[model samples]
Target: MILNNPSRKEIKNVLDHAKTIAVIGLSPNPSRTSYIVSESMQRAGYRIIPVNPRADTVLGEKSYASLSDIPEKVDIVNVFRRSEFLEGIADEFIKIDCPVFWTQLNVVDENVFNRLADVGYTVIMDRCIKVEHAILK
Candidate 1:
């Protein structure tokens, strides 16, 4: 069965209450969309955690090799990786206690969505978190 994302109101609620966002595949380069979006979010008051195995840091925050490496509480797991990499990310996500799993624009995986949703995780796919926050907040 196809999976649907939460409504605008639901998304707004998530953004409204979220304090920290863990960004998977976040790039250190300022030219990348991930960096730009994450920077915007960071400036907007939400703590941004960079989850990149190769980078040491991004947006002035320490970078973690994976989701499991983060030592703090993560309210949202925002993904910038391709759809093919989502399964691995989902695996790491489940190992953590993040409440929301968000895949960036054009990133979607039915299996990942189903798996996370089945386990009562709030999954938002193929949507830009920055845009949503800008419009909803």
Candidate 2:
């Protein structure tokens, strides 16, 4: 598991301050966890950028194929992909330079956590943003 996961204070701070999030691996299917989480964040007033190679739009927002394709800066990059793909996503995140990297529940990648945190990113792994939001709010 990714160590040094964000504390309650850090997670709360992130939710309080973050205005926009790029949700990687977001799905068009409403039943999917990615879609539900993105929707919840949107409801909470965060500008949700749905990023999926196969989708043009999700939850009424225009989606991008990748983070690099996004036109504006994102405060957070919430990932829903498997752990095996995280390093590649981390490589992409390095280019985007978003301050926060959030890997959803059950997704954990220690290498990504170390590398991203080393570069000053606030990384959260094996956590669901929606669940946290519900608790912290």
Candidate 3:
């Protein structure tokens, strides 16, 4: 079956309870959307963990090569990758303690969404986390 995005109420609940967000495909470049969105979220009081293999650090936090490399529990896994790259990260997402898997605007895949939902993850696709936080919180 297909999975739908959590309700605004549910999204707010997740954002309210969440503290740390693991940003997959985050870039060190300030001009990138991931960096911009992540920075905005960081300023809004959520800890941002950059999960990029090419960068050692970003926005003052030590970057991990992958989600599995992060030493702490993650509240959210915010992805900034194309749909084709999503399958590669599914394993790490499931291995972590993240409750939410949020994809940035324009990034989406139905099969992946359904699979994550089947495994009990709250998945949000093609939405901006920063925008949601600003509107819903």
Full-model lDDT for every candidate: 0.94, 0.92, 0.91
Q: Rank all candidate structures by their lDDT, best first, as comma-separated numbers.
A: 1, 2, 3
The candidate that achieves the highest TM-score relative to the unseen native structure = 1
**By summed lDDT, which 10 consecutive residues of candidate 3 come out lowest?**
1-10
TM-score sort, best first: 1, 2, 3
lDDT of 2 by residue, 1-137 (tens): 32888889889999999999999999999999899888998999999999998998999999999999999989999999999999999999889858999999989988889998997889999999999989998
Candidate RMSDs in order: 1.1, 1.0, 1.5
Encode model 3's per-residue lDDT on 29-53: one tens digit a residue.
Answer: 9999999999999999999999998
Candidate 1: Cα lDDT at 125: 95
What TM-score quantifies how close candidate 1 is to the native fold?
A: 0.97
For TM-score, candidate 1 versus 2, the one ahead is 1
Residue range 65-120, candidate 1, lDDT tens digits: 98999999999999999999999989989999889999999998999999999989
Top of the candidates by lDDT = 1
Please give each candidate's TM-score.
0.97, 0.96, 0.96
**Residue pairs in candidate 3 whose N, alpha carbon or C atoms collide under 3 angstroms:** none
TM-score for model 3? Answer: 0.96
